[model samples]
Target: RRADVFAMDGDTRWPGGCEGRAGVWAQLRSSGDAIGSARAARWPYEATELEVLGEGDRRVVEHGGFLRAVERFDHRAFGLSVAEAGCMDPQQRLLLEAGYVALHGAGARRSALLGSDAGVFVGIERPDWALRNARQPLGSRPSVFSATADTISVAGGRLSFALGLQGPCVSADTACSSGLVVLHSASYAIRGGECGRALVAAVSLKLLPNATLGALFAGMLSADGRCKTFDARANGYVRSEALSAMVLAETRIGGGRLLAASAVRQDGRSASLTAPNGLAQRSLLRACLAQAGEQRGRAHGVEAHGTGTSLGDPVEMRALAGVLGEATRPVQIGSAKASAGHAEPASGTLGVCKAMLQLSASQWLGNARLRRLNPLVAESVPPGRAGGWCFPLQPGQDALSSAGVSAFGYSGTIAHCILGAGGADAAHERGAGARAAVLVRHSFIWYDDVQPLAQHVEAAEGRTALRSPAAGALLALVRDHAIRGRCVFPAAGYLEMARTASCAADALTAAATLRGVRFLRPLLLDAAEGLWIACEVVAASGRVEITSGRDGAEERALHSACELVGALAPAAVSKPALPRLRAIAGSAVCTAALYAAFREAGLEYGPTYQTLGGAWAGDGGSFSVARLRRPPGTSQGVLIHPADLDGALQLTSLLSPSSGGGGGGGGGG
Candidate 1:
């Protein structure tokens, strides 16, 4: 599962669990052992129980292989207030982070997903943390409503809300099989043409005792602090905490593939509520293979739902052996639970993640904590031949072709997904004609020096320099903030650009401060052409200069210039406080009304430039809330984008003496 992003599990290997998939995989590959231990100190009750019964008496395995600073969320990043963040379920926070990681891994932008037909499907089983927190009294801390912040529906809705996604948002729970079931539903939604893209996540945080105690008393927890999946020592599962997310597009966005997925439900009368039906699982596998357009014998590996239980392990193996026995090669089987423990609703997701890693790695992964296999299942699937870290080399051939991930929930829900390695053909198909989809730039400016903000740094003549193409899309937004019927790129836009450039500087250059910024020429709006912006460090004192002109001119005209600073001297004198500004006693002007008024005055402003609220005085200046009219539920970035800040300046006209009716007039409403 860690290989989904190759993020390292920093908690196990470093100070914080931020190393990502690569780090996590490296640890697993090297140690080849279970990573967690039974906890006595994490919870007071568990500690007291351990103290009374001794350490050996405890059976509950504690897993801390989770993101670092779980409680410390960057509210500013998601545009949430401290109060809102405080009220949010910790699982919600984890899901948000996972969503971001998944999106980034998929090479998709949050801006693109927002307002698009992108659905959110989340699998969540534990609401104990939210319930417990809800019972606490609201003292001096921020108050949280249990119905909104802690609900399971909010888990999926939170993601959709935060990203401005307009597609269907659903939360599903089918006990341990929830994760795979959610994926199943998402795949169908894609097939049914409900959404173009989908975000699927499984988040579980073990913070409350009731949820754990219930499982423990039900004899579902292992007597030892290990998930010995498929081993004769198998007894029960180890509970785990995981927040995993994946972005699913109809077509592959990256190297991974979702060949097919299938979900099935068994009748309740067939067995006990917790019993797993081998017949159902076998049938589910068959259906899955068919959906994948693969034969029963084609898959090279299987990521099993091996929870290390005496009853469940054999049943699952039988299903696998029966369905995949016809394969030319042994269907390599493994369980993520063997290394990371069972993440309940997230178990299926982890299985899929591991399968993707194996397909990409072109090798069969070894089973951890597996020694002697269950006797009943051994005949159909041999212990040694079943699967391991086998690098089978067929003379010159390198890697296996395909693998399948299986998950069977106690709710009698079965889900299976097939994954295939992205071959040269697949890559070629993905990349075919991708250039044609790129935005057509009609500008005369050549894009030779154009670079992304992240890759703009270049050292030349003892100075760090950057060349950026004026993006037409960004300029469209900037063109909206106007003064006197003229479109001028805002100084704030340049400052923002400088700040972004400063991020590429070395540690010695603490910050880049601009001074005496002057705008020599206005960048008029051009439908077919865009300006080219450039920045360079000029002096040793962290002074960075910026200029904008023609794209390909050898010596283009400069539009603006300013000095940059890394640090500023502390001020010795305090500035005098100004009188508080008051809202004008008049009807407020809506953005549309203001724009119409501007049009009548021969000063037309679009959505980006129509920032005026209402005049506060007879002089024509007012300060109103300057908010971007983004799609409903879209989260704002930490710093306001340049276009937004510039748009606010449009309100000054109402207070200026140049206004037709002086400052006292109401907004041309």
Candidate 2:
């Protein structure tokens, strides 16, 4: 089965706590070491569990993964009552929040999902909160809400209900493979016409001590709480907590797409119930690759299900080597378990997310804590193949186009999925054909007048809207003001736009004072997109709001707002005396040194905004003379020059020179 993943998000509490996809990618690209000492608070009976396992000092199970602020959630925002929210499993809460974020990231709001044929598929184990609730006294039981809140089966239904979705809602539990299994199920449902879109989520939490005790008894957990996958020192996997969600659709929507998926059962013929079968894994990989058809060989790497087990790691490597066969270049393989610990049911989906990020960035992240390779696994593959098996210790560029993700359940269910870059086909589908050219016989017939503001202005009862093309003389000036390596519209430019609108709307020559001015958000200019700006004025209250967005988008973001008091009388236009300016000009501070200090603090000003020609400093306040480097032509129709205003405002830095806090002003004339 195949489907497009529009967006994905998650919250994780591995060695280093992270939230959302960007945070996770940052962690992976940087250290990729989220394994550390387990806290006693996470498992109160740590000592007792170790004693029961008969652990020696050299190999004690004293470490596990954890996160802070586990109990933090906003119940009111989700429309949940206090009592029901209290009884609800944290896994359920995480899925609900992350699902909402994922949908939003996909450019679909919860309102958009209402009554739509969008499915919800969740992969989670039995809730630890339910066990804790069962341990309570019968007399204090809140039976009505507990049934729906604590049950893992209702997790998908709860999300569907919250979004008013009408499509299939299914929850799966297949041990470690649960994440990828749900993903595979969602793809099939979409392909089968069961749902037009789907939200797939997986969550795992190490809340109670019993699960850890059971793992210790089964000899499944690592003693040092580190997953040294494909390494000789590998012993076992470390348990971690994670909640991840992704949105899938039939048509591509600016994200990675699944190429194929295959699942197989190992049966009970293996050496042990939990032991990985090489033959089964090899078959699974081949089946998945076969389903990918011509696109199979495009895969650049594999995200291995490396649990750090001595037997499991070797068997998986052999299966991978067998499937890869002879290749021009060795295929790189790594695992998220090495960096973030085994999130069990959530690990499979986490691997898929990592793969998507790798493809998007065209870079491969190194595995953490893999110091030495296992001799048996190294010997199984060819010399060249073995060399490519090891990933770099730091992030490096690779021509990544596709990736393979594997997840094997301890219960013998195995799943493999292939993901590829979907942008090319999407771009082709969205392509606009060449436009026909017009032929003119005479020069007089082809002549046209250019009226920049006249054609863009739209006037209504309360608002005056203006359109600014992405490319023009005004945008050229805006692009000249770069900050932090990006072309950002200056704060003074917003003030200028607001003032120009105020004068036109209120029938004034010029706005005398702007009160309670607030710069809410910066206007970031994109070369390919034009801007739509609206100035809404409340006549009675004198309130003005300036908002801007992409030309064709419905929603506009507020950039600047203020109260426009009417124009000043002719008598009040006289200049005041500047005694401080005269005194400080004699002992002026160097303008070059001041700009250098600004650069050190990350405020990069371009040639247009660097109009601070002469400056001065003193204890009272500080004074500066600023002038525009070149004349802004009259065709621009600007009431006041933004560059000159901005340069004058920059003089405020001298008031608290030593502080270097980079404070901003609230209002200005």
Query: Which is the leading candidate under TM-score?
Result: 2
Instruction: Give the local distance difference test score of model 2.
Output: 0.69
Please write out the lDDT profile of model 2 over residues 1-669, one tens digit for every residue.
344433333233333576655778888877566665544425433323343455452144456666545566666657877667666777777777778766665557667888999999898986777766654421232657877877878899899988899999999888899889988888888888899888889988776666776787788888777888888899888888777888888766545355455454553579888888899998888888777776654457889999999989989988888887454565778898887888888888888888877877788888777677788778668665533454566788888777889989998888888887665443332112412112121111100112222225556777665545544545655665666677777777777666666665655355556889898887777553566555666666778787776765788788888987877577877763456454545466677877777666656777766777766555444334333354533223344556667776777776543445233321111
Candidate 1 lDDT tens digits, 1-669: 101111111111111142345655664454344344324223443332233343433445343333335575655656777667666777787777677656655656767876888888998986765656543321213354546777888889988888888988999988788888888787777777788777888877665545656667688877765788878899888777666777676565645464544555652554688888888788888877776665422688778898889889888888777777656565566787777777788878777776765665676666777677766657556554434222222211236677778777777777887776645234532223432112111111101111232223567655777665555334543665555676656666666566655544543332345677666665554532655667776547666667766655666656666666554333533542323333332444465655666666655555644444432332133333333454421112112356444444545445545543333323221
After superposition, which runs of candidate 1 have C-alpha atoms over 4 Å from their true positions?
1-19, 31-34, 37-41, 45-67, 137-145, 295-297, 381-398, 424-669
TM-score of 1: 0.57
lDDT over C-alpha atoms for residue 491 of model 2: 79
- TM-scores, in order shown? 0.57, 0.60
Error of 2 at 98 (Å): 0.7
10 residues in a row with least lDDT, candidate 1: 2-11
What do the candidate models score in CA lDDT, each in turn? 0.60, 0.69
